[model samples]
Target: MRNARFEGKVAVITGGSGGIGAAVARRLASEGAAVAIGYRGNKDAADALVDELAANGGRAIAVQADAADAEQTQALIDRVVTEFGRLDVLVSCAGIEHFDALENITPDDFDRVFAVNTRGQLFAVQHAAAHMGAGGRIVLTSSVSASKAFFGHTLYAASKAAVEAMVLNLSAELGEKGITINAIAPGGTATAMAVEYGAGYLHPELAGKTSLSDWLKTQVALKRLAEPSEVAAGYAFLASDDAAYMTGRTLQYDGGMF
Candidate 1:
């Protein structure tokens, strides 16, 4: 069941090899958009996804860029436009998690989180919007932690909160250009990152053998963690014509945070 909602459109998803990012890439591609998967280091995964999408009859490419680097982020967009000749949507899903309290939080940690989750996303939009036309859409990924006060989430939440704020302000300016900016705030989701939660915290590269499947179920009204595809559905709506009139607001994909 493919839709032509995104036919002829081109989208670039940062952190495109991650669970949620990959899902968004597939979703947009399946709906008729030429997709670009941006990865910081996971070239293999990014390339594999591109191949899979192409095999499935979608146009895709893989590019390397660190989300935290402004120059690299700009280059990622430039390369995308070079490949597809147009930019219709930009989704920033590249983020990192650090579980430290105020006592343990350091400047480096704060900077890393904000650099990728907040600042990097801003620059990505800056580059994308310049190439976009009247019907452009920008969707940034914010986390439910931004509003939930989750344990060990001070830095992460603060960074994501900035994204929601960005959407609000960017809406007016982008709207003037006939483009839209919005966010998708997902609750505890079943992504590869959650596998790190088994270590008693969320974030890749942490010590863990446990997953969030059981623990996260208690955090939301829904009894299970959301799948990457479920979060992608929300992103798809924001990036499509269905939400053309919507801007400056976040589609809360949270499973009723409790």
Candidate 2:
């Protein structure tokens, strides 16, 4: 049973069709918040999630949008507010990753990554902040790669680093608005993106077999990779009234990986 704690809140989750975004959308909706899910592709998955939420007596809509596009991002925020009557929470989980050495990374890949991870996040927050009132919450999905200089992740790491910086800056700017902006930097978890990225180097299904808990035991103090739901718990807390005093912080949830 869910806590049923967000009885009257409204939330918007970008990249909500899959992975951590979908987990967070379900979590928030289960807790009683109305959710508008944003997706770039995967229309079927997005619609299915909306239907699932509605069938379970939760309010939800799947809006097609590319976070990398400013106009589309703004329109997504407008649609959520229009449908829900208000926007209280914003979860920016749309991102792209490319695995390549620093020298081999192309300009296009670097630009695309930043366009979604950093620029897109900024624009999403900008539009959401304009519509949100006091006590509004903004959560960006960052990664531990932001801080770790992982090999073959030069572009991806650079993009995540920018996102971390944005979260801190946005928190300071939005303080007067009574809105809190924060980020979550999670370590490796089993997701489609991870699977695709790891397939060439490892087995095709290696990502699926691996769990955050397994990694946590070795490199992480906690001995695991974080489940998407586990990361979603952090989003829930940050979005809740319980975290009212918190802002401009990045909660690293990588099983205590240093």
Candidate 3:
């Protein structure tokens, strides 16, 4: 049976058009939350997911909201509240990856990654907190690169590390509001974004050993990359009552990478 942990709750998933975000949407909606898919672009994808969820008897909608912009992030939360008359969970899965060597990194690279991955989540939670009464949950997405060493993750890793900082540092602050903030660090999820940018993180030695698709499995004890749904399960836990006492920490779901 689908859990009713989120019954009568409202959620806005920024980057809901993407792989991980879409999976999170499906997970939350299945658990009985009314979901609004806030996407910067790709209306087609977002709309399709909303339709699928609705057809399955879930309440869902697709909306345009740019996560990188604080004002827009604020708008998304407010819009969901207006549409559903309540706000409860915020799962920020909107982030970009930029991998480059020390010499090849650019200032723009730093700006874009942090803008969406860090600054965006800060404001989203900031806005969402203002509306949630109590028992509100915030789940920000981090990456394995933030906690461990990964080749060419100079920019991307730093961006996510900032997110980790927020999760750790803001717990006390959010606790005052009867809310909890946490994060999830997914290792290597089999998402389109992963396949698209995974190669850019390759150092010469790893690239020389094998193709990205094959080499990735060797790094994980599970011998495979995680499905986006697996990562979504992590998000669901943080957003549900089960994690009510859990905060100021990150759930690392990286397929036992060492």
Task: List TM-score per model, in order.
Answer: 0.93, 0.91, 0.96
Best by TM-score: 3
lDDT of 1 by residue, 147-208 (tens): 77656778988999999999999999999899999999987777778777434443444336
For the record, the alpha-carbon RMSD of candidate 2 to the native fold, in angstroms, is 3.4
The digit string of per-residue lDDT tens for model 3 on 1-258 reads 868999989988888987999999999999999999989989999999989999999999888988889998888888898889989999999988877779988888778888999999999989998998779999998888888887778788888888999999999998998899999999888899878877765566777667776776667788778999999999999999999999989899988986
Better of 2 and 3 by lDDT: 3
- Candidate 2 weakest lDDT stretch, 10 residues: 198-207
User: Residue 105 CA error for candidate 3 (Å)?
Assistant: 2.0
Residue pairs with backbone atoms closer than 3 Å in model 2 (clashes): 212-224, 212-225, 213-224, 213-225, 216-223, 216-224, 217-223
List model 2 lDDT by residue over 1-258, tens digit each.
768768898999999999999999999999999999999999999999999999999999999999999999999999988898999999999999778766787888878889999899999999999998899999998888888765577778888888888888878789988999999897776678776663322323555776534534666776555678988899888888889999999999877775
The order by descending TM-score is: 3, 1, 2
Off by over 4 Å in 3: none
